[model samples]
Target: MSPLFPALAARSARPALRFGDQALSHAELATAAGALAARIAGAPRVAVWATPTLGTAVGVVAALLAGVPVVPVNPKTGERELTHIVTDSSPALVLAERGAELPPILAELARLDTDITGSTEVAEATDTVDRALPAEPSPESPALIVYTSGTTGPPKGVVLPRRAVAATLDALEDAWRWTEDDVLVHALPLFHVHGLILGILGPLRRGGSVRHLGRFSTDGVARELSSGATMLFGVPTMYHRIAEALADDPELAKALTGARLLVSGSAALPVHDHERIGAATGRRVIERYGMTETLMNTSVRADGEPRAGTVGVPLAGVGLRLVDEAGAEITAYDGDTVGEIQVRGPNLFTEYLNRPDATEAAFDDGWFRTGDMAIRDPDGYVRIVGRKATDLIKSGGYKIGAGEIENVLLEHPGVREAAVTGEPDEDLGERIVAWVVPVRADAPPSAEELAAHVAAQLASHKRPRTVRYLQALPRNDMGKIMKRALHD
Candidate 1:
């Protein structure tokens, strides 16, 4: 197989990475990553304390170069979550910045401090050490052991093979029309797939350069885009802020309007924000769908219409099918029927590490159960309704998706943020409930007004039976609305 980063060796002084004010040329980053790769070359596995710093990127690239399966641990993880991840993916060494103070949970593991300045202790002997390094890892060899958020139970480690990474990135190349000419920009955390794999490694895979904001700010976005950056990656929260700021900041609107692509993921980007940004800058924010177990399953094509509320067609190699509750596949794409999404492709993870039973149950006839419920339009665009466990609300014998209701509520002038859920009801079996953050706390929209707003947009049956006002909706690090937290 070809190298994941085919251009890393040939680019002489071309910029490859930028964090805040620091930048690295392709040759410089190769030397630094290669120098570190030689140190942990033959280790069983390595854990990276994934901060948004350049060191975290260096450590991850080094591990990939060494063909070592890297476990990227979230730096802000609580004790229990950290312990679970470290214990599950028992790595021989934990990689972190030179002066990083690790938590007590990582005390048992050996540590390796990385120098982003290209001046490691073994810098002098880098050439000699790299000359004798092993060949590229096998396509099927494990590359990453990413853990789930563990919302349901203990977070399971999803083992991703090198083939999965290579296939997904290559597929993205086709879908996004990505090339070395593009300069990617984002401020997503380095710990998750969105930031680490797609945000960082994506640019490297395409031989393009990346400029991480280190921290997300509208000013930083305008600075990079106004200079030379062509693409922006962000979650819903960031784009929402951008939508909010575009009304006041003409520079931000101009910078965004000039960008080649604006992508949003991790959670759904509200149709309201999508329209807001589009009206201000004429740039449609494209959304994609994927998870930790599957790197990427579907995305809106670069050449396709940037439609709101739908995450375009399936990726090149991915085979997608919607399954009913009875395990039957939904064949028709009439654009209204909801079914659970199941996918099969080379982009899928190999297994749930050390969890044989869970892995066995996750697959059915080579297809992995995605647990996400969505509907496909006649044009083949997939619109995710919500998760089956939480987002699918069965009320009055009708299965309602919280996403549709939430989107309608977002369009309401009085509602700033909205989340939909269901509760036990004797009459309807389950009643749809709306949790809303109002634009004006003192004169918030009444439950009847909000319910009417949703009924006018969607069906009356999908309207919320009750509404609860809050200062803000509960969200996770990824900006996903945590409905479970509402009951908790």
Candidate 2:
């Protein structure tokens, strides 16, 4: 297999990474990471304390260069979850920035601080180290062990292989028409697949540059895009914020209008936000779909129609199928039948670490079972409705997707944010419920008005049977609604 980053050895002086005020040229990054890679060359595995900093990126790249499996540990992880991840992965050492205080759970492990500025004087030593490094780990070798949110129980470690990473990014290079000329910008956290692998590594693989906003702000996004950044990668929450500010900030609108591409993922982008942004900037925000277990499954192609509600066709080399509850494949793509998304491809993770039973149950034949529920249009676009575990509601013999209802609710002028889930109901087997954060809390939209709004947009059976108000929906760092927290 070819080197993961074929261009790193070019030693160009072009800017490769920029985080806030700190920037590293391609030559500088190669020297720094290569030197560090030599130090930690033969470790069992390494844990990277993933912070939105230059050190985090340097550490991860260094690990990859060393052919060591790197586990990214969220800096905000609570003690219990951190303990679980450390125990499960059993890394030989932790890689972090100097002076970043670690939690007690990680006290036992040795720490290696990553330096983003390795002087060019060390170029010879770095080259010697790279030359002496073992043969590049095979494509099937483990690269990352990312932990899930543990919503169901303990967060399971998703073991992503190098082959999956290379395949997904190369496919994206095809789908996005991405090239080294593009300068990507984002403020997403570095712990997950979306931000860490796609947002960071994708650019590196193409020998492109990335400028990360230390924190997300409309002004920062506008500055980057207006100055030179060609692309933007964000979750739905960031787009929603962009939509909200576009009407008031002319600079923001101008920057967005000038951007070559805007991509959203990690959660569904409400159709209302999509239209709002499009109307202001005349740029359609493309959405992609993926998970911790699968790096990326689908994306709205750069050259194709930017359909607001759909995550475009299965990526190149990926096989996608919808399965019914009876385990039969649903071949009809009439745009209304919801089914569990099952995918088989190089994009899929090798296994859930240390969970053989789960690894076995996660696949049917060869397809990985994605708990996401989605419908397909005749044109091959896929619209995710919700998760089968929480969003698929059976009411009065009709199978309903909560995402459709939530999207409709978001369209209401009075609703600011929305989440839909199912509750046990004796008569309907399950009842649809809407959790809303209103635009005006003092005079919130009445439950009756919201319910009627949803009924008018979708079918009456899909309307929420109950509405609950909140100041804001419970969300994680990635801005995904914590539905399990709603139960509490």
Candidate 3:
């Protein structure tokens, strides 16, 4: 088969994209990508640094069509981070938005006489012929190299193959029931896998249109949803912000009524936010599971009853196996037994780019060790506990998963978002502390009231010993709460 875009081009002639009043048919998108591909034929890699926009979408697909690896950098990434990524994955070409300020790496590229252009205006001088570079890239061939968000050490490059991309699109389409008529509201950042694979490529693969917003704003998203977007994807924080916006203006909630599916990923969706959104908008948030390495593994189905805590079953073509610390498989029927979530499937990444030792350590036997702790129910549903490294909190000689306390805290009416962590204490080994962002500023609940909120839902040991109110919790680009920062 031809590359993803060329294959998509033959399947539909309908509008493939809509960004702020700009709409492009499949034919137009193909033509633009083909022309840009011809221009960058000699380049080895292309980097894009803009928020979600039509041009950003076109540029990314164009680079892939041209047989070049696409590197998407976070807009908030500082000069030091950008420089490291650009230098590590040296690119011959760079496509960015007009007047989009360049990171230090781009400035270095300019000094090195590399080709960089404003994605909005494609040069007319380039060749327009659609050249078939290679129909099937090797399964080991690197199609895209994305750097991790680096919650711990320096971000490592994750090299994924064309086959992995194809697997993800196919699995998502089958699981989510994405169709040609569906229109996705693309507001997530392009640098992350949730946006690149799920937000942009996944929809386009099924001949759907993506309504791109340059940046995520509550008002802007409300306006887009009002226009006519059928599917919407966002992190938990973005959904919380929209929920806040709806409180002030009830009309905004009506705009979201048109959406058939509202997805939350990149982080755990707080149970309080999930239930609040359902009551407010009359739609239950579909929380899915994925990461930088694996594009998408599980989703809370739209047609099925969305469980509050579980992330649902594995997608088609994806196999999930829970194993104990000794590398033995754990049965699904086991009662409340938590183990490491392991996966073996086509959707897994080829390897970490240029890091053989790291790649070797990532897998056990043939299954990729996800490093995430989870429990499988009798029905095969998976509820994530937390990462094995940081999930375990020692409080009063008992080890606890922060997710347990966070989930319970989220049930409170006054709490909008919550993150739980272990703090050093002289009396106990470590005390369970809760940091919360209230739904309303002036309506902040007292610590006693919040503690009561937890006491009503959780056991005595699981309840937090201390509570602190904050305006916002620190988060990475992908929307995962930065629990490590809470200690400081």
Candidate 4:
């Protein structure tokens, strides 16, 4: 496939993106990208630290159009994380917002005479002259290198090829029925795959318009939905917060009536939250499954009765299988049997960047081992059990899923958020512990009350032995819970 800028430029006069008060047509966006790309064409890689705005979008697409691999670093990240990403990527150029502090890597780049630009002014160039650059990227050529949340170790860069990105866009377009008329609300952070691939590229591939929200706020998201956004994509936590904020406001609830589709992913959406969102907005939330390594693998249909706990069927061109510990294939129709979830498709990442041994260990034959445990119902819909690495809890000679306990904990009326992990125990080997964020700080439930709450829903061995109150659960930049970090 040709570079994304040229493909988008074909519809130059059409509206491509909308920021706070600025709108850019496809031609204008491409022109701005070309100008920026020209300045950094010789750079091996470019790092960007800006919020999700139209300017950042132009810079990224432009860098790619110029054949420079773009690494999107979160603007809110600390200096240490920023340094690691920039040094590992070895970016020759850095684009940051004016007045934003530069990390040490940028200082090193300056010492090396690399080009680094920072500006608050949005690109105003409307001239349609397209500068010549490498138009065709090889299918295997790395297009973007996104770093994972590093649940196991330090974050490793995940290299995605142009073809893989294109294929994911194609698959999303077909599966989600995205059309040119759809106006998407782009509110998620751009550094993560959910926002970049699902929130941006997925809509743009269908020639849809995107309104980028710099940050997620309940009122801000409500305002965008009220502004006639046809489709919305966000992580589960964002949706849950929005639902909580709008629980008492009927007008705000009415404002969300214009949304045709609401998608939730990145983390599991609690079944209770899903029902609450549907009750408040009168729109069913379609939950999908994906990670940084794969753009999108499966989705619960928008038109169908969305199963509360299932992520539904795999998308077209995506193949999924469940295997036992021995790697033997299991029946997808078994509703109670759980196994490892493996995937294979054109959208899967080629490999983790510079981690050949990890990559070799990641694949079983040709299928990518997702390290996620899942159970498929008789309808072929899959429900994620938990992560294999961090979700196991041992108690009374029995193994339990922390997700199962967390799911039950989230059902409590007083619970706002929940995370479960195993704490060391001499008798049981490992004891189940729950960290809960309560809805009301003044009247938070005690550990005994929470333990009783879980005892009612879970098996005796699966009940949490301890419930700790926390202001918030530890999460990485992508909003995934860091259970190991909590343990530490």
List per-prediction Cα lDDT, in the order shown. 0.90, 0.90, 0.75, 0.75
- Give me the overall lDDT of model 2: 0.90
Give per-residue lDDT, candidate 1, residue 258. 97
In candidate 2, which residue ranges exceed 4 Å CA deviation?
117-134
Q: Output candidate 2 Cα RMSD.
A: 1.8
Over 41-153, each residue of candidate 1 has an lDDT whose tens digit, in order, gives 98989999998988898899889889999999988899988988888888999999888889987867898887575456346545553343346788999989999999899
The number of the candidate with the highest TM-score is 1
RMSD of each: 1.4, 1.8, 3.2, 3.2
Number of clashes recorded per candidate: 0, 0, 0, 1
Candidate 1 achieves a global lDDT of: 0.90
Which residue pairs show collisions in model 2? none
Ranking by TM-score: 1, 2, 4, 3
Provide the lowest-lDDT 10-residue window in model 3: 111-120
Candidate 2: tens digits of C-alpha lDDT, residues 397-434 = 99888888888999999999999998999998988889
Query: Estimated TM-score per prediction?
Result: 0.98, 0.97, 0.89, 0.90
Off by over 4 Å in 1: 125-134
Candidate 3's C-alpha lDDT?
0.75
Per-residue alpha-carbon lDDT of candidate 3 for residues 1-488, written as tens digits (9 for 90 to 100)? 54575434573578787777666777667766666666676577778764566667777877777668888877788777777788788877677655566766675563211122433224442344243333445655667888997667667888877778888888877777778778888577888788887788877778778887767887777777787778888888788787667778776788776678888887787776777777788888788887778777887766667877778889888888888778999886553677888887888888877678989999999788988888877878888878877776677766577786788877777887788877778998788788999989798878888777776776677678898889998876667788878777
Candidate 3 regions with alpha-carbon error over 4 angstroms: 6-8, 110-136, 247-250, 332-335, 394-399, 424-429, 438-452, 469-471
